[model samples]
Target: MPALPTVRRLSLAGLALATTVAGVSMTASAKPPEPAELSAAAQVNRTIQGMSLEEKVGQLFVLFAYGPDAHQPDARNTTLYGVASPAEVVAKYKPGGWIYFDGRGNVQNPTQVATLSNQLQQAAIGTGLHVPLLIATDQEQGVVTRIGPPATQFGGSMALGAARSTADARTAAAITGRELKALGIRQDYAPDADVNINALNPVIGTRSYSSDPKLVSEMTAAQVQGFQRDAGITATAKHFPGHGDTVDDSHTALPTINHTLEQWNAIDAPPFKAAIKAGIDSIMTAHIVVPALDPSGDPATLSKPILTGVLRKQLGFRGVIVTDGLEMAAVRQEYGDAEAAVRAIEAGVDQLLLPPAPAVQFNAVLDAVRSGRISERRIDESLLRILLLKLKNGVFFEPYVDTAKAAEIGPAASLATAQKIVDKSITLIKDDTKTLPLSNTPRKILVTGWGVSTTQNLANSLAKRGAVTTVAQTGAAPSDAAIAGSVAKAADNDVTVLLTRKAWDSKVTDKLGKQRKLVNDLLATGKPVIVVAVQDPYDIAYYPAAPTFLATYGYAAVSMESLAKALYGEIKPTGKLPVDIPVAGEPQKPLYSFGHGMSW
Candidate 1:
């Protein structure tokens, strides 16, 4: 959105003299070109053609803030960037986008978030840059949600996958997108397109839709439409070529996938293809390496063969391609600070996200363009995509939001929609003792488990149902003393409802052993034990002897309400398993096949 190049203006006498010298008639051939006649793409090209080398490089970066205010600095988080405040950083670097992380003090309430976004935008525009800054967040809901209460916390992709309803998927996306747009955030890194085929995947368990590529494809396409067409915010289908099969977290270590070219085409490629067909404006690259696609051992973020060859040529996606955080160990496995940005751009990625040293990365790429290692045309290709997306998503015209109005939206109605999604996704995977549909409304219950918020929410939900509820203080990874204390408390309760987390994983040896033991010991007390798996439903496979079990896909508040209502038979459980759960020691055998659900 830089200023359009204009013809020189002449004074009245000079205009008459020039017109006489030119000897042109006052006709169509003599009419000057108007800005309104330019195509959107042409205007974007002019904007890119008008940028400085520094501004063009700035257009390719999306950095996260550590401080709270635009002009004020935070002392607690000073490690990532220098001591510059958020506004100061924007003025200095002029990043094309700014992403918020609540853990870094960049986001708080709706009004505060809106104010911060406006301040960032104001700073960027103040630098004589005509295009508005793209504000974003990882509001994927479920576990990775950055915003707090008052914003709708939808059960993420796996919940929609479990429900197996594209309407529900679209609804989830629309609601979350509305909340984001209201807060002046124009983009969301959500609708995770990875097929969660590996049950033990450490990073992308509930983030992905399902193990089946067809289901992922349907949900991915629906979400793309919801986010772009319905909600008017840019949706990024992320972690390309599948991050769902890895056991290692990319934040800490590098993980490699051995899926053959055929396997990738069948498993990982479909969701992206569907996304492209659905007109997804942004595609985030995976940091993991796919040996079958590229035997050169480069991760997809740096591999030109994977990003350019397969994604661009084979799939024909002309949208903006973004990289995962360059600070992550997966991208940093081979290269360091400066070269990562240069190589990622060389690989056809349009945006470089959250590299550790933004200044170093920016200068290196600028120098590369000057040294002829990377062409200026290559940079313009990326800028064209970015600018067109900005124009498409209404970022240029409507970058600001009413801070007060933003605080009012996405609270009641959006939360109801979010709960509706989770409510439909509560899968009753096991019921051996018919312990559900409790006849006595005032039954004594113990809510214990991995997620403290979920446990407390479940306690609140059951209490509303007239049950005397007791919540144990055991953390997710509990100690033996805490488990023993919870067991002692279970003797008084009529039914002990406990939660268990990840159990079936090769990398994790402990495997939620204490949570499993807590459930068994609770059952030994002659109390009806209702176990709910918050994250991976495979948590129940470790405790095969349990009488009653359920899989909520996630531990969102709505899931707890669904669990409470299903327990009392107020509403029937209609959800099915999105993935197959294996027995404790057998990875190949299935304990409960996909689409397994029981109802009264």
Candidate 2:
């Protein structure tokens, strides 16, 4: 006697059996598949077999379109893609995935995002292969998070680094995944695996967990567990072969990673290795050139030696390999839109993200396959991985999210956990004058910073604690009048607190100089000047003579509240430095070592 599947059979001799497992179907001529054979691979393979060449090519690229409404066509979008709307785009290309960009109006709120996702799926279901698209967004949390308000804005990866708790990493990823699930988002291009060694790294500073490779690896692995295993959403570890050490932005131009093979193994390999071991669903390739990896001047996105030889063969990564934005200058300068797609596929990439003209690229790849420039077998290899991702992400069964439930599961749901992360992450860098804990009152406190609204909110937090506060939004490189006004307020107030936002990394002309003047001006007013760094703890390195200092990894709502609480001793500072704050004029010695923190 053999165990039979809990499925429906229509006839005895020639029954059509419908299985709950992966929606598998059994024909009358075929015997039931073994338990192992009944897994999603079989169904995914069947899906591949049924797809046409056009559908197959479409599945290889993750494209983007304009407008908040999926059904309503934007005039520019129609002329560009020749597709009336998102639904029209889906029906035309039969793409493998779609990326959500907030600035492009692809996402508005939970309900709107959910509607967009469902409409995209509806279009896919109505098309050739009827395969659900793998939806993705850069919800990296903290600084680079794509979805705003209503979405739980956890502190960035650097905050996670400061907390020094892998448990927090997992929990944060879980909470983020839950919210994304509510809105029908299935993939997160996050848990940036780049070991941010460059202090001047403009793009990945707050995004990378830490400068320490081991710390980054631990946090990366734990986040994978949180995102994929616990939260049930696909998590992609990105900018492969390390985008962390470069000072230049890959979006604008190509950056070179000048590490030797041994150095690369030490700095850049740990986090990606950890990600692979933890079973990350996808790995996004960088657009940077690593001379040691491939001396051919090819970025990782189109480097066979990097993507196929190193990541696939050396690292033994069997999951999907996705290219970072194809429209980015790093790749565009090297190859045209269509040629890059062909090159990426040949280089062993599974998904092409954000091609400028998706249709043009799609047709190019299709033509390549027909001309034997790319093989159909290569296409299936990538398609199989993507289909598995779809399976793991639950597109086969739970294709749509309950739009009503998404509102309840919005940012409010994760506020507690978010506040907890920031609370545990705020660090008291120094207190030269012992002016900390503000003595319960300070006649009046002036909270002046870059963002008018952000500083006002911090002031509001203080006022709630029975302290009178004034706020000034000193725009970057504050004018002489703004600085004089702040000094005058400092004279009126017992304590003047100045907030700095990445002042060290400012590209604005003499931004750091103006800030120093403002700080020294406030100090001259005979008030206990407290400098609070709202983001990028390194701001204190420039102001060594400051009376007091605090580091909140981000300026999110929770971070602001936590910063205020830490100032007045309402909460203890528990954060540690995740990266070194270099001593000015001495890059060799740091003003503060990694994990350095002074707690009360």
Candidate 3:
């Protein structure tokens, strides 16, 4: 990556404030096309002019891989392409991009990641046209983060949204961009623009910034500016027109969202519009079916009316349209991998991300163009868009990044800012019994939870604040005997603090039921109990009658520290709920609505 000039290296928050006060006098949109853009456009036209049918089709397929390594001999090697070394796959197939996935088999340190990126770029350079690969990953931060340890870990979208400041959102995204750029990754499938109105939305719960469309729009726009302008990386606002309203995870099953165009316009479409106005690099297609857009019930990933008509014509987003992973059950169960890949391109998606079988899908798309099923002109159009994105980001000029900088940039500047975000996002939903501040007059405190570290952190913090603190990790969703023993143990303390974490998936409802019973048993003891939900805010809805409740939105280290402070009353709990937590059966009746918070 090209090193930015020191004069232009103002922190993202400072740049945001400066732009706000002075009225955004300088921006990529405001300035004329740089020499790089002009050169890239000419180069793309020239390259496209000379490409064969197969070579042009290759530019549309962006496959998934773990790291630089080949697939091990195991049952898990499911993809048809890239079973060998990634470099060999690139040399053979010549893909336009590569998507990195973590935790399966390939995990590397920061230097290793930088080296792998260099290897991948070199492989692309070896191929004809030398179009630098668009290397990307799910660097959405918080729990969904891919590259880490060396990379700075910030809170997710909901945590930033709780702060209710665009500047804060900008800063968080900019910092994330800086870290990603250092690692030689140019594209981030992040800043989820989904308006999480449904508390039961499994995949998008804490990933979404807020349920309020206006706030989601503003924060998403700020994040786009931060990632693009401040970090010089491409930002993709995803799961359009919105994936937040559905109760199902697209990875598991096809989810249907039955919103009229009026409702869609009001809630789901605004953030994407704001993202487009902020000049986002791309918009990823959701697999969910929206009956309002396409009555045929086609998922957005394969719906021409939705992608070409609504996103392209209505929203006017001309940058690029990328598809979510095609292997996901939402699309795979309905359509074959190769068939879906071809249809996705026909439906107006510029990039096909993470196909189940890359070679088969690539050949299917190639065959489509050759047989006139997909016109050569269509192939050329997508090729130009892909090449132009490469040029716009200067990936052609500086495909490899500084290994030393990759190791050094993220941590030194990000810790304090991350801590501050966590502090501002810890919401105190209720303290009705005045259980908070935990009675300063020297009392025994028992911190018990499913998470050992969370319980220990609270115990440690309380111990520092003059209370004798003890902790127990009552094995998450414990059995009746385990729950009974933990409850009996809790009776020894003057006050009991229960740390709870909830999953947004309906499958976990049974597990939450078990945890709820434990909470009920704790409360039945008649000892003052405070519930700290360190993850999903909806945990409060499951245990509404707890004496006091707090929501941290996540369990990042900073969140834990900030939560401890909030518990000890060292800092006031000022954070507000970014989403509504409705009653279990009734979606309209919220136990604690958005923006609800309390302090002692």
Candidate 4:
């Protein structure tokens, strides 16, 4: 989906749905009554003392709110998001919390999300002890946004890094948190503390703030303050001990970091340490195994030494420790969900995130306690931490959110702020020929790329600037004939602009190799070939010969529009490189430094 239309359409759909399903029921009047005057610890102790074994177990597991396979209009009957319905899952497992995921087809917009949260909370309130669910999601604004449309989307961590403004970081996070809070979400798994040092790292690419631990540390701390203090939402510093240095993605298989303790402390551990000192509410464990931290090669999620020893005792982190999804292969391949859950609790993780089989995991932990394998005191400790998070975020007294207000907030103020930040994040890698700030004179322009929508938007923007533009929406590295046809048409244009979207290529095939060849082929022509990297800035390493190169570090419509404005000298390019782009066969040496950027 195009970035602009995605937000606009999502907002409209969410508003319409909110009017139909939510209506006045989601107003401030729906906010739950304030709990009795008692300290958070006192209330948690009282609640825990009254809870049953099943209720306590339920509080430990955070399951996906909707079924994954539920394709029907009534998704509650599907088995993908665990059980038949949200109410059914709550009643059956008495889960401590639920997370919304769009990948499972259970999520649509902010309206449906708010309604679902309210419904899930109602079910949890009806259960024994009536503890509110710890509603959460990966609302990491940039690439990993769960709640779509209507929610004001920002340029994420790398963009913040390029903007290099702690004030902007805090403001962006605050906007994200405010929007999430409106949708009844209390916890944000964001401000990724991972310092992306390895260029080949797949998952943590733009999600990380910077390669510099100092920058990542300051930005993450600012993000936490924005989410917790400004938006009144619990902020979680994630993928702990750093998932940035390793090339392997934990989502697929277990990744191990062999860096020594000294290296880890210098590069990866500083951001997390800064987050802890910034008074972060939660810390999420990575699925990767750091051999330096734990010699057994166990994923940190399942390691007692890393979770309890390093994070708890060594770092002096006192907040809740959450595990990265237990369903991930990093943990699941070695130990099943049930065994993993038991071990994770034993590892001192306060919350089990997205266990595939919540009931089995719950039962396994329950049985472990019964068999004296896992003590009741341990469970109580986790429960206290969980309850403390809810209380700290005001989840108990104000779980229900004003959906109408939420619909108004994200789109109204966020888009403007996002545009400014994204504009600032537009990095000029190499403008040797000074082909940018294209003249206002009428000229033929050939705008072609596999990323169709963004290129199309760029074409339209160029047309408005008096350049007669033609678009060839080549889907994912066009064929030889297609490239020839595009080149033939480019012969008619004054300048050829090729937009490429590639962060990391698959191990199976060099997917971006074909695209790189196309750019080089286009450059072979006499016309100036301007390469705009919409996704990853590292693409310039492949086609450095391109006369002009720009890195937006994003492909959103706002980013594209900002690029267009910069091209016309309306918005001067100000963004710097957030990560080093290594040349071929030189992993340690970078063609461009971290702060490299130039403008006309």
The estimated TM-scores of all candidates read 0.92, 0.92, 0.90, 0.90
Per-residue alpha-carbon lDDT of candidate 1 for residues 160-214, written as tens digits (9 for 90 to 100): 8889999988888888888889888989998799998877788999888888899
- lDDT tens readout by residue for model 2, 315-417: 9887789999998999988787888889999999999998887778888999999999888988877877677677656765457767788777654447877
The list of candidate 4 runs beyond 4 A from truth reads 1-41, 67-82, 503-512
Q: Rate the local accuracy (lDDT) of all candidates.
A: 0.80, 0.82, 0.79, 0.78
Output the better candidate (1/3) by TM-score.
1
Instruction: Indicate the residue-level lDDT of 569 in model 1.
Output: 88
Candidate 4 minimal-lDDT segment of 10 residues: 1-10
Question: In model 3, what are the clashing residue pairs, if there are any?
Answer: 1-401
| Candidate 4 per-residue lDDT over residues 1-600, each given as its tens digit | 001001111121222222223111111222222223223334555677788887888888888754432122334434544556667777777777778788866577666667667777777777766687888889886678787666777777888899899999999889889888888888999979998888777788888989999999999999999998899888999898789988777889899988899999999999989898888889999998888899987899989899999998899886789999887888898877789999999988999998877667778999999999988878877777677667667776456766566567566567888888778998888988878887787788898875777788788888778888999866555678877878888888898888876624535223646677678788888888888887777778777678799987776677777888898898889998988889855788878999999976
Backbone N/Cα/C clashes per model: 1, 2, 1, 6
Regarding lDDT, does 1 or 4 come out ahead?
A: 1
Estimate the overall C-alpha local distance difference test score of candidate 1: 0.80
TM-score for candidate 3, please give it: 0.90
By lDDT, the best candidate is 2
Off by over 4 Å in 2: 1-39, 411-413, 506-512
Task: List candidate 3 stretches off by more than 4 Å.
Answer: 1-38, 67-79, 439-444, 452-469, 503-506, 509-512
